[model samples]
Target: MHIIQFEGSSIIPISILTTIASSLVGWIQVKRYSELSASYILTAHEIGVIKEQASYVSSESDFSSFIRDAETAFSREHTQWIARRVANRKPK
Candidate 1:
């Protein structure tokens, strides 16, 4: 007669748990980076639009308005990036 009992064998379970945790962390980092990149692209596009509009504006006030709008958009994008970075920070 032979009997086999599974005991004190946690390697497989631990390895799987580690893999899942790592994957989740990696996914979060990738998402955060993607969001940051998108924000940058949006800011760049806004700047381009502002430049185009400025070229056609015939008055100083109109040019100033476009510059103000571009600045606001940039500020908003920076804030969003900061928030995402804070949210994605690793727990201690």
Candidate 2:
């Protein structure tokens, strides 16, 4: 659609677009979306492993261990999320 077309001065439009793209990328990094996604993926894998262990839970102790491990995975993820939020809030 070329809504930002500039007649006879193409550099201005290109420069403006570059600046906007850079700013958007910078904002995404500052928000740490990638790190948050990694954390989620790791947590999901840990939970999946625990679920697999559930099938073999034949004793009370085994069930207790599974629960503890599952809770630990959840706590670790929550702790990381809280830490990231706190870090972002700190003055830079």
lDDT value, residue 88 of candidate 1: 66
- Predicted model with the maximum lDDT: 2
Give model 1's TM-score versus the native structure: 0.65
Question: Model 1 clash tally?
Answer: 0
Provide the lowest-lDDT 10-residue window in model 1. 1-10
| Alpha-carbon shift of residue 67 in model 2 (angstroms) | 0.9
TM-score to native of every candidate shown: 0.65, 0.66
Per-residue accuracy of model 1 over 35-69 as CA lDDT, tens digit each? 77887888889888877877778788887888788
Global Cα lDDT for candidate 2 = 0.84
Q: Cα lDDT for residue 79, model 2?
A: 93
